[model samples]
Target: MAGDTKEGVTLELVTGSAEIFGTDLQLNKKYTFPSGTRTAVFTYQGCTLELIGPTVHAYVSNNTPMAIFANTHAGLEDICRDTENGEASRGFVVLVVGPTDVGKSTLCRILCNYAVRKGRSPIFVDLDVGQNCLTVPGSISAAIVDQLADPVHGFQLEQQISYCFGSTTPTANMPLYELLIRKMAENTAEWMKRSRNACISGMIINTCGYITGEGYKTLLTIAESFEADLVICLEHERLYMDLNRDLPNFVKTLRFPKSSGIEDRSQNVRSYGREAMVQRYFYGTRALPLKPYRIEVPFESVEICQLGAEKLPDSCLPFGVSADDHHTKVVYMKPDMKLQHHLMAVSTAKLISPEVLNHNVFGYVVILEVDLQNHTFALLSPVNELPSKVLIYTEVVFMDDQINL
Candidate 1:
C-alpha cells in the first residue's frame, strides 16, 4: 500500500486491513491517489482490492509556467549550440526553487521531458532529498535523460548518480549537507567534462523546498556551485526578487505563479511522504513484489559509519575534548545489537578515510537483529549479496511492516 503515486491509481480496499505509511486506509471505500509523495500501503493482513491505474490522462495543455520554462529551454538550446562550437565552457544550468508543493518537481520533469523530445540529453539533478525523482528520498541524485519519462515511474533510470543524508531536512546537519552538495557538484562537473553530450545538453538542478533562512542560503550555495545560468522561482515573487538582487547580474531569474493544480503538503505530510519512499524501496513497488532476504554475517565483515552530529556540550564531555571537531568527523563504530532495525546504506568503497566517505550508496540493508548471543549480525536486504563491506548509517529509519520483536 505504500507505493501509490499521484499520477494515477484507483482502488477500493475490499476485504483486509491496509495502511499508508502510518495512516490507515478506509475499507469498502474508494481511494484515488497520493497527492505527490511516494506512499507505501502495508496490508497487515492478506488484503484484497480492486485496482486500476494511469487512470488520469490529459492533452498537451501548455500552461503559462510550462510555456515560459520551455521557452527558457529553447534559449538553453542556443547555449548548447554555443558549447558545441567551443564558445562556452558549459550550457545552461537551470536551477528551480520554490516552497512546498508549488510544482517544482513537476516543472523539472516537464522541462526534462520537453528537452528529450527535442533530442537533447540533459542531465537531471535532483537535490530535493524529500521527493523521489531520480532516486529515493534522503539523497541528492542525478541522471542523464535520453528518453522521455514514464508518467508512473518517472525518470527512475541510470541507477541515478546519488548521495544520501539519511534525514529529510538539511539544517539539522547543515555543514555536512553543504559538503555533500559540494561533492555532488564536483562529481557532476567531472561527468559533464567527460561527456560532450551532457555538456551541451546541460542540467536541470532540482532543489529542496526549504526556501528561508538556512534553506534559502543553501539554495544560493547550490546556484553558485553549479554556476546556474537561470533561476526559476514558482509562486513567490519575493523569492525571485531576492535572488535577482543578490546573485550575479548574469544569472537570469523567473518568477512564476503556483500552478493551479499543484498540491500543498504540510510538514507532517512531507515526513510521511519520505517514510513511504523508504518503505517502498525495500518492500518493492506494487507493480513488482520484492521479497527481501534476511541473512547473518560476522561482526567484523563490515563497519557502520554515521554522518554529522550536533556537538556534545563541553560541560558533558571529558576535559580538553572540545566540540570543534565533532561536526566533520564520521563515527566508525563496532556493530552491535543496538543497531537493530536501523536502515544502513551499503557503499562500494572500502572508505578508510572519513574525508573520502561522502560517496554514493550502492544499496541499503535493515538490521533485523544483531545476535550478541552468537557474535553475528542479521540484516534484511533486497538483493541477494552484499555489494560491499562498508555500511553507512543514515538518519533514515524505516520500521518493518512485519512485526519483529
Candidate 2:
C-alpha cells in the first residue's frame, strides 16, 4: 500500500521500494512514519509494508470523533477571545487516555494537527513516559503546536519541555512515574501561565497505556494532575465507562472506536521501535542523516548517577555506614566498565530531589569507552560541552558501534 498513514507510527519497509513523505525508505528498515493529513502513498513499481498502529482517518470514520473533538476545540477557541488584562485567560484542557495500541497518542497528535490546521495553537503534553511522540521514549514531555507538523517530518522538537523517566514502563518504578507526571504538569502549567496565547490556546495531554488496577487509578491521578476538563477514551469500552463512573461530574468524557488498522505490538517489535526512536533522535531521517559529533569527557569532570537502586536491608549493611541510605533514590556511581556504551542525561534541575531528578535531562551522552589507565570516559554527544555535571543514567543504552547516521 503506497498511502500515507493517518496515524503516525512505526511503519516497516518490507521487500519493495516505498517513499514515505517523499523520502524513499530502505528495504527492511522500520520507520517512525508519517504522511500528510490526507496524503496517500502511490507506488510506481512495487512496494510492501506494514503500518503498526491506528490511522487518524480510519479512527475518525469509525464515528467521526474528529469532528466532535474539533467542536470541543471550537468552544475552547471562543473562550480564548475572552481576555483579561489584554491577555487570553482560560481555555479547555483535553486529556487523552487508554490502554496501549488503542490509538491514544495518535489521537492527541491529530487533535493538535487539526487545531494547527485551523490556525490555532495547541500545547501537546506527553505524559506517556514510555512512547512519547515529542521527545525520546521513557520521557514526560510537552511541546506547543504553533504550526502544523510536516506529514513527513512529524512533530518539531525545537521548543520542547521534557523530563526523562529513565525507564520505559512505569511499573518499574510506580512512584517515580507518578512523580514525573506531577512534575510535568507543574512545569507545563507554569509555561501556560507565562504566555497569554499559550494559556488561551489550550492543551492536549497524551498519557501512557496503563489502564487497569494501579494503571486505572493512575488515570484518575493523571487527570487530576493536569486538571483535565475532557477525557478522550478510545476503543476500550470499560475504560470509558470506568472514567465516566469515577471521574468528577464536571469533567467531560468522550469515547471513540479504535481504528481497524491498529495492531497489538509484540515485545520484540517494541524493542526495535525504541531503538528506532533513539536513533532518529540523534540522527535525523534516513534520507538526510545527521552527523552527531562525538567528543570524550574526562570521568572526573562529570558526575554520573544511576536511578532506582534496590535497597539493601539494614541487617545486611555494614555498621556506621550512612544509617539512612536512600537506596530507592538516585545515588552517585563510581567509575566502572559497565558504564561503557551506556546513555546518560545531563541534569537540568538545580535542586535535586528523588522525584525531581526525572525532569532534569538537558542533553544525552553515550559512553564510548572506559579508560582505567587514564581514568577518562570517551562519550558521544550531539553537543560538545556538557550543560551540567549532574548526570543521571537512563534506561536505554546504545552500542558503541551502532550506526546512528
Candidate 3:
C-alpha cells in the first residue's frame, strides 16, 4: 500500500504483520505519518491496515519488486558470510544507480535495514546531493547504519561525515563533486578498518539520478573510487549496458525494473523539499524542536572561500584553452549585505586554500545578517561557537521569518 498524506494520517495494522522501510509495525498500535509524507507499507504475508485522515491519494497493490529486493539482500549476506569465514579479504560494496525517481533511495534503505536486522552494520553512503538522506541538500554524506531507520524520521544522524559541494546538482561544479566523492571513499575505507562488523558487512552507496554526459562520468568515478564490487542499475537499461561495457571485469552489473509506486516530482516540489530539509537541520523536527544559537562574529576573525573558477571571456583565453581550466579555484570573499540568507559551510580546515575542498565540513550556518559598517555578520547556527576559522560559501539560500539579530 502507498499513499500521500496531506494533513497528516494515522495507520493501524489491523491484521497480519507488515513493515515500513524494514521496520516492523506494532499490531493494534497507531502510527502517525506527518503531512506531505510519501511512503509505502510492505508485507510478505497479506495484511490489512486502517488509515485515517486526508490524503492526496491512496492505493493497495500486490504487485511490488520487494522479492527482488529481498533476494539482493540475501546475496549480500552471503558475501558477508564469505568474508567472515576468511574466504574474502575485504567486505563487499554495493552501488545503486539509475535515473531520478527510480526508487534507488528506497532500495538502499531496504538493503540497509535488512542488513541491520540480520546483525550486520553496513555503512550508508549517500552521493545524491539533490535529495540526500544522510545530510542536508548540496552535500555528499555517509553514516553507519547500525539500526533500522524510522519510517517518519528516516536515518538517524550519528558520526556522519559530509562535504558540501555548495550546490544541489553536480552540474554546478563537476570537479568539486568528484573531489568530495574521493575524499568520502578514503574516509569510509579508514572507518571500515576500525570495525570488524562494518568491514565484513560492507557499504551501500546511493547516487543521483543524473545519468547522461558528465553525470555518467561521475558514476564511473564513484565506482572506481569506492572499488564497488556490484553495481545495481534500476529501470535504466541503457545505463546498465554502458556501465557493463565501460567498467572493469571485476565489477558486476545488474539491472532491475523500477517500482510501480514511484512518482516523479516537479521542480517546485523538489525545491520545497530542499528548503524543508535545511529548516529541519537547525530547527529539528515537530517531535523534537531545537534551539539554534544566533551569534555575531567579526568579519576579520574568519576567512570565507568560494568554490568554482572565475569566468573569463573567450577572447582573454590563450589559444584553444577553455574557461573550464581551473575548476577548483578557491576565491576569498569579504562579508557584505549580499551574503545574507545564504548558507555557509563551516570547514574543518584552519586556513582558506584549495585543500579546503577536500576536507569535510564541521557543520553549516545561515547568514542571518551581514553588517558592512560594523564588519560583523550574524549567523544562525546549530552550535554556539564556530568550530573552525574557515568557512565555505554555497549557492543554497534559505529565508526564514524575520528576526532581530
Candidate 4:
C-alpha cells in the first residue's frame, strides 16, 4: 500500500506483519506519519491496516519491486559481513543514482535501515541538494545510520554534518556543488577512520534526480570521490550502462526497476516541501516546539560574501584563463535591504575569500529585516547566539508570515 499524508496519519497493523522502508512495524502499536510524507508499506504475506486521518490518496498494488530490493539488501549485507570477518580489505560503499521520483532515496533508506538492524552502523550521505532528507534543501549532509529512521520525521539530526550550497539545483552552480561533494567525501573518510563499525559497515549515498548530460558526469565524479564498490541505478537503463562502461572495473553496477507506488511530484509540491524544511529548521514541529531568537546585530560585526564566478569580458581576461575559471570565487557584499527574507549561512571559516569558500557552514539564519540606515540586521536563528561572524549568502529566500510578529 502507498499514500501521501495530507494533515497526518496514524497507522496500525490490523493483521499479519508489515514493514516500511525496511523497518518492521510493531504488530499492534500505532505509528504517526506527519504531513507531506510519501511512503509505501510492504508485506511478504497478506496484511491489513487501519489508517486514521485523511490522506491525499491511498491505494494497494499487487506489483512492487520489493523482492529485488530485498535481494540487493542481502548482497550489501554480505559485503559488510565479509569486511567484518577480514575477508575484505576495506568498507564497501554503495551509490544510488537515477532520475526524479525513481525511488533512489527510498532504496538508500531501506539499505541503511537493514544494515542497522543487523548490528551495523553505516554512514548515510545525502547529496541531493534539491530535496535533502537529513537537513534543509540546498545543502548536502551526512550522518551515521545507527538507528532506524522515524516514519514521520525521517533521520535524526544529532550527529549530522551539513554544508550549504545555496541553490536547489546544481545547474545553478555546478562547480560549487562538486566542490562540496568532494569535501563531504573527505570528511566521511576521516570519520570512517575513527569508527571501526562504521568503516566496515560502509556508506550508502543518495544523489539528485538530474541524470543526463552534466548530471551524468557528476555521478561519475561522485563514484570516483567515494570510491564506490557498487552502483545501483534505478529505472534508468542508459545511466546504468554508462556507469558500467565508465566506472572502474572493480566497481559493480546494477539497474533496478522503479516502484509502481512512486509518484511524480509537481514543482509546486517540491517548492512547498523545501519551504517546510526551512521552517522546520528554525520553528520545529508541533510535537517539539522550538523558540527561535530574533537578534539585532551591527552590520560591521559580520562579513557577508556570495559565491560566484567573476564576470569579466574576455578581452580583459588572461590569455588562457576563461570567465568560468574562478567558479568558486567569493565576492563581498554590502549590507542592504536586498538581504531581507534570504537565508545566510554562518560559516566556520574565520577569514574571508578563499577560507570561506573551503569551509562548511555552522548553521543558518534568516534575515527578518535589514536596517540599512542603522547599519544592522534583524535575524531569526535557532541558536541564541550566532556561531560565527563569517556569513555566506544563499539564494534561498524564506518569507515567513510570523516574521512581523
Write down the TM-score of every candidate.
0.79, 0.78, 0.94, 0.93
Residues 114-148 of candidate 1 have per-residue lDDT tens digits of 67767788888988877756656667778888877
- Sorting all predicted structures by TM-score, with the top scorer first, yields 3, 4, 1, 2
For candidate 1, the lDDT comes to 0.73
Model 2: CA > 4 A from native: 1-89, 286-289, 314-328, 350-359, 400-405
> CA lDDT, every prediction?
0.73, 0.70, 0.87, 0.85
Positional deviation of residue 115's Cα in model 1 after best superposition, in angstroms? 1.5
Estimate, for each residue in 89-189, the C-alpha lDDT of model 3 and write its tens digit: 66689999999999999999999999999999999999999998887888889999988887666776677899988899999889878988999999999
Give the residue spans of candidate 4 off by over 4 A: 1-6, 34-36, 286-289, 318-321, 402-405
Q: lDDT tens digits, residues 1-405, model 2?
A: 222445555666687775432235667776664433223333446677666665444321233344455576666666555643345446678988888987787677767766665666778998876676786777778888886654455676566777766788888777777877888888878878897667777788988888999989888988898888889898789989999999999899988776555667678656756666667677767545666757767777877777667767778778885534443477778888988877777778543456436455786777778898898888777777777777777778777456443
- lDDT (10s digit) by residue, model 4, range 1-405: 323545678899989988888888888788877766778889898799988877767788878988998888888888878888999865689999999999998899998888888998999999998888887888898999988876555666567788888889999889888999999999998888888988888999999999898999999999999989999999989888889889999999989999988889899878988888888888876646577889889998889988875578878988987787567888888898899999888899885767676788888899988998898998998887888898888888899786643
Model number with the top lDDT: 3
Clashing residue pairs for model 4: none
Report the CA-based lDDT of candidate 4 relative to the real structure. Answer: 0.85
Clashing pairs in 2: 2-41, 3-41, 4-41
